[model samples]
Target: MRFDTVIIGGGLAGMACGIRLAEAGQRCAIVSQGQSAIHFSSGSFDLLGRLPDGTPVTDPVAGIAALAESAPAHPYSVIGAERCARHAETAAELLRSAGIRVAGDSRRNHFRITPMGKAKRTWLTIDGYLTTDDADRLPFKTVCIVNVEGFLDFYPEFIAEEFRKRGVECRFGSFNHPDLEQIRRNPSEMRSANIARVFDRDADLEALAAELHRCSEGCDALILPALIGINRNDSLELLRARVGCPIHLLPTLPPSIPGIRAQQALQHRFRALGGEYFLGDSVLSAETRGSRVERIYTANHGNIPFEAAHFVLATGSFFSKGLLATPDRIVEPVFGADTEFVPSRSEWYTLRFFDRQAYQAFGVKTDPALRVIKEGKALDNLYCAGAGLAGFHPVQEECGAGVSLLSALHVAETILKIEN
Candidate 1:
């Protein structure tokens, strides 16, 4: 197959780049191994939640500017704060255009309630999920934390305890329906995704609405786990119409329904714009001519190769197999791209688990243009984005989605400019 651009990973970065390129009349294709890190997301995108020194960031634009100066080799610094700010606006509009309604902006950060009920700073949060502009204050005084009867992922009592600490009159409630009993029979299968499948039907939603209406009689709002709207974005709206009080959702543990929905929605948007999507396929090797990557061979297509004028490596960090950690060194597996890591394996991590580890900052080495470097030479047609790129720790800095998104946009814009 031939395309204008062939992205190696189908995560947030690859999808965003493909969508941008396809929208501009460039033929784009993406090869995905399986699920990406978005599946474990909290349904929130972070820009620069905290500085390198652990100081919280209230203004993301300012934070990016500070990051550019503090961390010169970081992706945000490479893209520059001016372009990062512009790309931030573009990303929000792109998500909305793809039918993913989100709240918050690039100018400032908002607080999203974590599964443990802690307020974490983030850039964009999917709508219908709880977000407060101020961490010290909540919009509602009285609220009810409701959970499915047998769902073990969400603990309403823990959430209620946190709310009470904030001086909110919070209470806990449980709802059960015949439709959920089948899934509840197996503890392992009673997850957010499965519960969302049951709630997709109108009959099941109506039953849930009736139960919520009874539980939320005098409460200011109803807080539930993010278990609806997996297949349909309007599931929450439909349930809200049938209930009395307002409804807000809190993210659950892994197999996140909101994350899955966002992934599905973005892929749908990319395909709708004439982008080719090759899911469940792995890139086995790449064919390079001089400094340019001519084509890539995948596991599914044994002999045939995907040819493109430009390529993007968004395969993600070690967790996604974008980069491999061996006994002596870390490596970018697919194309043997240059990576930045500690020379000694003993210095890779610290004894404290919560402490910032050196390995989190290790990834492919890219130039100012975000092109991947191999043996001291930059690949003309190859670029790197997302967690695969070196510098900036996502977990420590809380800028994973921000770097994934903004860097993808930067690479896409660079390709478009080169084509023009």
Candidate 2:
């Protein structure tokens, strides 16, 4: 099959790009091999939370400007602060249009409390996770953290203790799901996802809400693990309607329901805009002529070949298998794009676990236009975005979603400009 654009990787970057291109009336296809790294996302979009020197960033717009002046090779630097700001606005517009309402803005960031009781500064967060005021205000009195009986990841007591350390009047509460008896029979199946699956039913949710309504009375606000529902907005609305109070969600480890919902919303909008999506398939290889990619071959039922006028490489970094680390070298798997890495593997890591690791900064090297470069030459029709792009440690810098979102829109905008 042929399309105007073929995006590899069905993560946030690819989905964002596909949505924008499809909205612009381009034929687009997104190839995916099951779940994306988004399932592990905190459901918050972080721009630049810290400087390379480990300084916390309060104003992301100002941080980007400073970063552009200092680190010219950083992805945001190459993309430019002006374009990055514009792309952020465009990204917010597209996400809202796609039914994912986000809270926060581009100018300042909010230090959102994590399930681990630590705070992460982020640019935009999904609306359901924030307080009703939409400000970075914490519930001062009668704050309750709800823990599911069998959920291993979220510890309400630990979270409450942490909050107490910060002088917040926090309390912990636990509720045993009626369906817990069924899952307790199989210890292995008692995961957050399985529990969420059980909660997907309105009847199950209503029961839980009744329990919460009793437990949550006189509480100023209820902080729960993000397991309210997998459909996020719908589940949040349902829970709000039934429970009736201010609700804040804390991100738990892995299989993130909020992230899943965001991806689903983007995918839904992409398809609604006439884009094709091939899940449980991966781009195995590609055909390239000179600097232009001709087509890509996926590991479909018949080794399907997909041709596109433009190809986007959002396959992500080592975590997503976009880049492979070997005993000898770090290599880009599919397109063999040049990777920005230290030559010696010995320099890849530091002695202390708390210290920053060099390997985390390893990824693809992209030109200013966000095009993939191989052996010092930019590919004509190939673009790169997301974790695959080198120059920033996503965890340390807190710019994963920011880079993905902005770069995706930037790539789409670049393609549209060239076409125009």
Candidate 3:
């Protein structure tokens, strides 16, 4: 198998890079191992939500500029704020092109209502999800949080409690149809995805609309757990139209329907542009010729090698096994790429659970051009992006999505420039 580029992970970063390259008439292939961290998304993308000093960011463009100065070794710093801003715009347009309708802007950060009802700063939110320009003020004065009867994942009462604290009139309600009764019987199986499957039917959706109307009386808007649209936004749009009042979705627990839908949509767009997607496949080893990668062998296609001019490592952090930690050191398994980590393992994590941990910042070392370094030499054709690159704490700084997206675009732009 041969392609112009081969991406080793099919998460947001890999998909973004693949889509960008494919759109430019490059043959791209993405090898994915099951699901990515997108399954745990909150239906929002973050672009420098907080500075390294833990200051909440209001404007992301300014935030990037500050981030570049404070965290000089960070990926955004390496790309520079000017290019990061450009990539941010391109990333938004790319999502729209892939059928993912998002609200908010890279220039400013909006407060997205989390599942716990707390406001978290983010860059781009899915269109149906609730977001506010001001964290202290909500758009609707009165709201009713509705959840499925037996779904334990969504806590309508908790959300209502939080809303009430904000001086808003809040109510909690639940409605279940006969179609969902069977799935509701099994406590474990009644997840957002399964409920969404039942809601996919027109009749079920109509019933839900009627139920929401009943529960939403005297309320300015209705807030429902995101369980209606698994594949597309049409179901949520139809429900909102049928309900006759403003309806907003709150992302449920992990395996988020909106995130999965976005992933599927992006993959579909890549395939439409003549890109190949290999899901449930793992890259086992690579064949390197000095500083350039020649081919990579996968677990499924044992002996068959995927040959490409450029290779990307977006396999993610320790969560996805992109960077592994042994007793003595951190290692990038596939290509034996050099990693950035403290020599002492004792400094990996702090004693406080909520405190920033050092291990989160540990990842593969890369050059200013985003090329991976192996044994003190940068690989000519191997680039690293997303959570795999070193130099910043994602959770603490709140820039995971930004790094994933902008770094992918930066690497893609570099590859395109080299191609030209």
lDDT of 3 by residue, 1-420 (tens): 999999999999999999999999999999998788888889999988888889988899898898766899989999999999999999999999999898888878989999998889999999889888888778899998888898988888788777887888988878888999899788999999999989988899999999998988999999999998785468977987888889999999977998899899999999999999999999999999988999999999999999999999999999899999998899999999999999999999989988999999999999999999999999999999999999988898888988999999999999999999
Clashing pairs in 1: none
What are the clash counts of all predictions, listed in order? 0, 0, 0
TM-score of each: 0.99, 0.95, 0.99
Query: Where is the poorest 10-residue window by lDDT in model 3?
Result: 228-237
lDDT by residue (1-420, candidate 1, tens digit) is 999999999999999999999999999999999899999989899999999999999999999999867899889999999999999999998888888888897988999999888789999999988999888777799998999988999988888888888889988888888988899888999999999999999888888899888888888899999999888768888878888689999999989998898899999999999999999999999999999999999999989999999999999999899999999999899999989998999999999999999999999999999999999999999999898999988998999999999999999999999999
Error of 1 at 88 (Å): 0.5
Query: What value does the lDDT take at residue 376 in candidate 1?
Result: 92
Residue 318 in model 3: lDDT:
95
**lDDT for every model?**
0.92, 0.84, 0.92
For model 2, the superposed segments whose C-alpha errors exceed 4 Å read 130-137, 301-304
Poorly placed runs, candidate 3 (over 4 Å)? none
lDDT at 80, model 3:
93
- Pick out the ten consecutive residues of candidate 1 with the lowest summed lDDT: 230-239
